[model samples]
Target chain A: MKAFISKNKWTLLLLIAATALMLVLAQKTYYALIIALFGIYAIVATSLDVLFGYTGQISLGHAGLFAIGAYSSALLTIKFGVPSLLSLVLGSAITALIGALIAIPASKLVKHFLSLLMIAFGQIIYLIINSWTEVTGGSLGIMNIPYLNVFGFEVNSNLKGAIVIWVILAIVLLVKHRIIRSRVGNAFIAIRENTVAARGLGIDVQKYKVLAFAVSAAMTGLAGGLYAFLRGFISPETFNGTQSVLFMTMLLFGGITTLAGPVIGAIVLLLFKEVFQTFSTYQGLIYALFMLLVLFFFPNGIIGLYKSGKTAVMKLLSKRAEATRNGGAENAEN
Target chain B: MLKIDHVSMVFGGLTANNDVCAEVHKGEIFGLIGPNGAGKTTLFNVISGFYKPTAGKVIFNGEEIQGKLSNQIAQKGIARTYQNINLFKKMTVLENVLVGCHTQTRANIFDAIFNTKRSRAEHEEAIRRCREVLEFMGIGHLEDSLAGSLPYGDQRRLEIARALVSNPKLLLLDEPAAGMNLTEKDILTDTILKIRDLGYTVLIVEHNMKLVMKVCDRICVLNHGNKLAEGTPEEIQNNPDVIKAYLGGAK
Candidate 1:
C-alpha cells in the first residue's frame, strides 16, 4: 500500500479506477451526482491552490469569477440562443478578461487587506446577480440551458458528467503542475517569498502577481461554466460571498502548498457537509465545529498530519535498522 | 571600469554623499575608508544603482547606470554583496548560486512548457556554473547544504560566489571582513587578490585598516560625506585630515 501510494502517477491511475468502480456500483443516481459536483469543486479548488498555495496570494473573489462564467454561459445559451459548448468556452474567456481587470487593482494591495477587498468584490458580484432582474432573471436564474456534448454524444447523465468534470480538472492540474516546475514558477515563489528580492533579481514583480491572479481566475471561471451546465441552472445564492469563504477555507484546510492538498480538502469538506445533511437543520453548526477543530489541532491541514506521521515512522524504522547494524557488528567482532 | 562624476545625494537636510568623484579601473582593488556615517555605503549604494543621486551620474563601461534598477545594474556587468550577507535562507547553497544565474538563462515559457532540449541545456548550464562558482570559492562540498546552515566564513565566501556567477565586470563588496577573525581575514584577503587576478575590478568598502592597507592599490578617505583625502595607502595613512577623520579616537 505504501509503495503504491508513493508513486504519484500510479496513485492517480488507481484513484481514477476506484472512482469509476464506485460510480458503477453506486445504487442511487444522486450519489453519482454528488461525486460529479465534487469533481467540479475540486477543479476550482485546485486552481485556487495554484495562486494561493504556490504563489502565496490570498484571493477571496474566486466565486466572482465562477459566477461570471456561469452567468455568461447561461445568458448566452438562453437569451442569445447560442450553442452550449461554444457558450461555455466564451464564458471562460470573458471571465478570464474580467479576472485580469480585477487583478490590476487587487494585485497592488497587501495579502490580508487584499482578501478583504476580494470579499467586498464578491459581494458586489452577488448583488449584481440579485438585482439585474432583466438579464440574470432576477435571482430566479435562467433555466433550461442545454447540456454539453462532445463529438455528438450528449453528456447528460451523472456518470458522464463525472467523467467530463474529471477530464477538465486533470487538464487544469496538469497545467498547474507544469507551471510550478518552470522558471515562471520560480519567479512566483520568489515573489511569494520576498518581493523586494524578486525585484532585485530583475523579475517583473507586478506582472507575475497579475498573471497569477488572471490564470487562477480563468481556471476558476472554466470550472464555474462546467458547474452551471452540470446543474442546468444557477442562482445568485449559488455564488454568494459565503461560497467564496468556503472555497478559501477548503484550500487552507488542505495543505496550502501542496498540489494534491486542495482536492483532498474539497473532498473532505464536501463529505462532511454530505454527512451533516443527515442531521438536517444543524449542518451549519456542525461545519463550524469542524472548522474550529481543524484550526485548533491541524492548522496545516490533513497533508501536514500525514507528513509528520510519515517522518516519525521513518525515524523509528531507521533507528531500528541502526540498532540491528550495531548488534551485528558486535557479534562479528566477538 | 566604474566612473562616478560629481555624484551628490542629499537626504532632506543631511547630505549623504556630496559631490563624490572616483574611478575604479579594470583589474584593480580599490579601497574606500571613511568614518562612521560618512556616506561610504551611500556612495556604494549609488554606484550599484540602489539610491539615485540628487545630482551627477555613474557610468560603468561607457554606459550611464545612475538611475537604473539594482538588478538591471547587476545584469549589466555589475554585482554586489551586502554588508549583512543577503542570501536566500530556505534555498540550498547551489540553488542560491543558480538564482544568481537567472539573467544568463534563455529558456522561456515555451521551453518550460514542453521541457524542451533548450530548457534542459539551460538547466544543465546553470548547474555547471553554480558548481564552478562553488568550487572556486572552496565550498563545493557544501553545495547541497542549506544556505542558512553554513558557517559564517562560508556564508561570506558563498556571497562572493553568488555575485561572481553573474560574470560581472565590476564587483562591490561591503565590509567583507567585519566579523572575521585574523585567519579568516587572511583567507579573505587571498580570495580578494585571486578575484582581482580574474580580470574583474573590485570596489571595497571596509573598516579593516590592516587588510585595506595591504590589499588596496589606492585608498580614498571620506569624512562627513565629503572626500577628505585620496592617495596611495602610505600617503593617506600619514595625511592630517585622514588622521583626524579616522585612526583617531573621536568616539
Candidate 2:
C-alpha cells in the first residue's frame, strides 16, 4: 500500500478506474452529461488560469471568444452548408486568430485599462451578433444546427455529445497542464511575482505574456466551438459582458491558481444555475451574494479551503493519536 | 572584462555621472565606495545595463553594451544583486534560483508543452544547477522554504546564489554587507573573497569601509557622482580627497 501510494501507482489506478466508471455511465445513463458540462467548464477555467492566475493578467473578454466560436461554427455550418466538423475546426481557428489580434493590443494595457478594453471588445462581439441580421439572424438567433457525425457515428444524443466534449476537454486539460508545469509556466510565474525581476533574470516577459494570452484565447475559442455544436444554437445575449463576468466568477470561486479549481467552481455554479432556475430573475443576485460569501471567507477560493482543511484534519488526528498513546502510558505507569 | 569609458549621465540639471571612467579586470574583486548619493550604485546600474548613459559607452568583453536592457545585459554574462534584495517573495528558494537560470535553459515552447525527454533532462539539469548554486552559498537546506520567510542574512545569501546560477562572467553586488553586524560582516567578507576565488570578477558597491578595504584589490572613491580617487586601498584611504569625502574636509 505504501509503495502504491508513494509511487503514485494507486493514484493512477484510481484515475483509470474513475475514467472507466465515467465511460460506462456515459454509455448507460444521463449522469455523464453533468460530468461533460463540468469537464468543458473546467477546460475553459484552466485556460483562464493560465492568463490570470499564472501570468497575472486578467481578462473579462473570454465570453467573446466563446461566443465567437459558437457563432462562427453555428453560422458557418447552418447557413453556409459547411460540414459540422469543418465548421468547428475553422471557427476555432478563426477565433484563435481574432483572439491573438485582440490580445496583442490588450497585453499592452494594464489593470483596469485592459479590463475596460476587454469589456468593450466583448460588447463589440455582442453588437456584431445583434446588428448583423443578414449573417447571424440578429437578436432572433439561429437554430436547428446539424449534429456532428464522425465515420457514421452521429453525436445526436446528450450522452454521446457529453462523451465527445469530455474527450476533447481531457486532451485540452492534459496539454494545458503540461504547458503550465513547463519552463514557460515558470516564466509565467516569474512575470506574476515581479515583471522587473523577471526582466532582470533575462526573461522576455512581454513575449510570454502575449503567448499566454494567445494560448488561453485559443482554448476558450475551442470551448466556444464545442458549446455551439452541443447546444445546436447560440445567441448574442449569451456572449455579453455579463456572461464574461460569470466566467470570471467561476474562475475565482473555483480557486484561481488551482488546476481543478475551475472544474469544482463551474460544476457548483452550473448546478446552482439549475437549482435557482425556478427563481430565474433572482439567480444572478443570489450568485453574486454566494460569490461574495466565498470571497469574504475563502479568499483563496475553494482549493485554499480544501488544503487548509486537509492540514487541520491531519493535525487533529495526530494530536488525538498522541494523546491516546500518552494516556495509555500514564495508566500503565500508575 | 568591463570598461566604462567617459560615461556621463545627466538627469535634467544634475549630472549623475560626469565622464566617469573605470576598468574592472577579469577575476578581480573591485570596489566602488562613496558616501550616500555618490552614484556608486548608479555606476553599477549603468555597467549592468539598467541605466543608459547620456554620453559615452560601456564595453563588456569588447562588446558595446551601453543602453541595452538589464535582461539583455544579464544574458551577455553579467548578473547583479540589489542592495535591497529583490527576491520573488512568494516563490520557494529553489524556484527563485530556477528563475535565475531561465536564460541559460534552451527549452522551447513545444518542448515545455509536450514535456519531452529533452525538456525533462533540462529541467533536471536546472534543478541540479540550482542545488549546486545554493549549496555553494551554504543555503541548500532552505531550498523548499519561501524566500520571503527566510532570515535577512540567509535571504541575502540566497540572492547571491540566485545571481550565480546565471553563470555570469562579471557579478555586480550592491552593498552586500551594508546592514550586517560586525560578526556577520566578517563572514560576508570571507564569502566575498571565496566568490572571487571561484574565477568570477566581482564589482561591489559598499559603504562598509572595513569590508571595502579588506576584499577589494582596488577602490574607487566617489563624492556626489564625481570620482574623488582611484587606487589601491591604502592609496584610497590616505588620499586627501578621499579623506575629505568621508570626513567632511581634510586639514
Best DockQ goes to which candidate?
A: 2
Local distance difference test values of all predictions, in order: 0.82, 0.84
Report the lDDT tens digits of candidate 1 across residue range B1-251. 78889999999999998999988888899999998899999998898777899999998989899988876876787888878878777667887787677667766655765778878888888899889889988999999999889988898998888888878788888999988889999989988998988887899999999999988998889888898888899999889888877667545
Q: Runs in model 1 with CA error above 4 Å?
A: A1-22, A25-27, A76-86, A278-296, A325-334, B181-183, B249-251
- CA shift at A175, candidate 1, in angstroms? 1.6
Which candidate has the top score in lDDT? 2
TM-score for all predictions?
A: 0.88, 0.92
Q: Which stretches of candidate 2 lie over 4 Å from their true place?
A: A1-34, A75-90, A149-153
List the lowest-lDDT window of 10 residues for candidate 2 chain B. B242-251
Docking level for model 1: acceptable
